[model samples]
Target chain A: SQTIHQWPATLVQPVGSPLSLECTVEGTSNPNLYWYRQAAGRGLQLLFYSVGIGQISSEVPQNLSASRPQDRQFILSSKKLLLSDSGFYLCAWGGTSGIYEQYFGPGTRLTVT
Target chain B: AQSVTQLDSHVSVSEGTPVLLRCNYSSSYSPSLFWYVQHPNKGLQLLLKYTSAATLVKGINGFEAEFKKSETSFHLTKPSAHMSDAAEYFCVVSDRGGGGADGLTFGKGTHLIIQP
Candidate 1:
């Protein structure tokens, strides 16, 4: 069975602070990875997706960036966080065979004050 | 371009009553559709998906959705609503082209409220 892990589960940060969120998947290799953000009572917004190591496609231009350092490891980073960056971040993985069904990680809730 | 529209923003139903959440979609080609549920403070969980093979797709937790191509709609339904079923539901659509790299377009979501 495939599983995704994300941390730190929840975080509270002051404005203009650096941010880093990590996601790792087990039981699968070469899977596509994605990063999504959801505001309270809002739909999920795609931020970035990676097809392979060092390959990332960003959907929205914002204060966040994503990196695929390894085959199953994806990291979301921000040099400086904005108040608008407060939201729930999700990591997802899908098979390389063009499957649209994605498996999501536990997610991280970030609160910027 | 592909998009999804959830017809209802909020739906309230008494426990044990039938549940229905309507969704409409637009796509240039044959599209893949999905339903996902998100409980408060949790990640999204895929409920069901339609890939053109079967019009009626059954998912976890006794949830099912029918794909109507003529209507361009895929509506989720359940025989009985449970208290645990109260959550936010999102309707999603993905393009079949570009090797699935187009990602998914999500609807605003429908909040399902289970009344006791």
Candidate 2:
């Protein structure tokens, strides 16, 4: 069975600080990875997605970026965080084949103060 | 382009009562739809999905959803509501031909409340 892992489970960052959230999937290779943000009282918004290593697609323009360093490792990063950047960050993976359902990780809660 | 709309923001139902969360979607062509549940501060868990297959899809935890293409609707239902079912439900639409590189559009969500 395949499983996804993300950390740190929770994070507190100061304004203008750097941000880094990691996501890794085990038992799968060349899977599609995605990053989404769920703001308070709002639905989730897709931030970025990657089909393969070194290939990242941005769904929306924001203060963050994504990178797939390895076939199973994806990272979400920001040079400087903003108050609006605070939200629940989720990492998801799907098969490279046809349109399939995605599986989400436990998620990271980031609070920018 | 594709979009999803959840009819209710909050729904309250007594325990053991039937659960129905309405959802409507718009797509250029045949699209994939899904229902996901989110607990407080947790990630979304897929409840059911409709991907050009069975009209009625059964999911985990006694939850199911029916795909009504005529009405452009994919409504989620439950035979009996449980206290644990009191969480936010989301309707999602995906029209990408293939691969997860395409992002999914999510509904604002319906907050299901269970009355003891």
Candidate 3:
């Protein structure tokens, strides 16, 4: 079975502060990774997705960016956080073949005060 | 472009009653649809998916959804509503071009309220 792990379950930062959230998947190699944000009461919005290491596609223009440092490790980062950046961030992994279903991590709650 | 629409923003159902959450989608190709549940402050859990397989897909917790291609609808239902079922439900549609690289489009969500 594969498991996805996210670090810093919850965090509170001030505007203009830097942000870093890490996601790692175990039991799977070369999986597709994705970063999604869910606002207070809105549905999830895809921020970024990576098909392989060092390859990332941004779904929407935002204050954050993503990087796939390793085959199973993905990181979402921001040089400076904004109040609007506060939300629940989720990491997901999917298989490379077919219309594979995505598995989501526990998620990180970010509050930018 | 693919999109999903959850018909109800919020639905209230008494416990022991049938549960229904409506969803409709639009896609250029054979669409892959999914239903996910989200507890308060928790990540989304896959309920079921329709990928040109069986029209009726069964999922976790006795929940099921039927894919109606003619109507472009995928409505989720449960025989009996449980208090634990009180959560937000989402309808998602994957890109027709295929591949995990394409992100899914999610519905705003329907808040399911199970009343005792």
Query: Which candidate number has the best lDDT?
Result: 1
Q: What is the lDDT of residue B30 in candidate 3?
A: 81
Q: What does candidate 1's lDDT look like per residue over B1-116, in tens digits?
A: 88899999999999999999999999887888999999988888999999989899999999999999999999999999999999999999888563556468899999999999
Give one digit per residue, the lDDT tens place, for model 3 in B1-116: 78899999999999999999999999887888899999998888999988888999999999999999899999999999999999999999886564446648889999999999
lDDT of 2 at B10: 98
Write down the DockQ of candidate 2.
0.75
lDDT of each: 0.92, 0.91, 0.91
Q: Which ranges in model 1 have alpha carbons more than 4 Å from their true place? A: B98-100
lDDT by residue for model 2 over B5-94, one digit each (tens)?
Answer: 999999999999999999999988678889999999888898888889999999999999998989999999999999999999999888
Instruction: Return the interface RMSD of the candidates, in order shown, one decimal each.
Output: 1.3, 1.2, 1.3
* Greater-DockQ candidate between 2 and 3: 2
lDDT per residue for candidate 1 within A8-65, as digits (tens), equals 9999999999999999999988999999999886888899999899999999999899
Q: What fraction of the true Cα-Cα contacts (under 8 Å, chains A to B) does candidate 3 also have?
A: 0.59
Interface C-alpha RMSD, model 2: 1.2
- The candidates, ranked best first by TM-score, are 1, 3, 2
> Lowest summed lDDT over 10 consecutive residues: which window, candidate 3 chain A?
A94-103
Predicted candidate 2 versus true structure: per-residue lDDT over A50-95, tens digit per residue: 9899999998998899999999999999999999999999999984
Residue pairs with colliding backbones in model 2 are none
Error of 1 at A38 (Å): 0.4
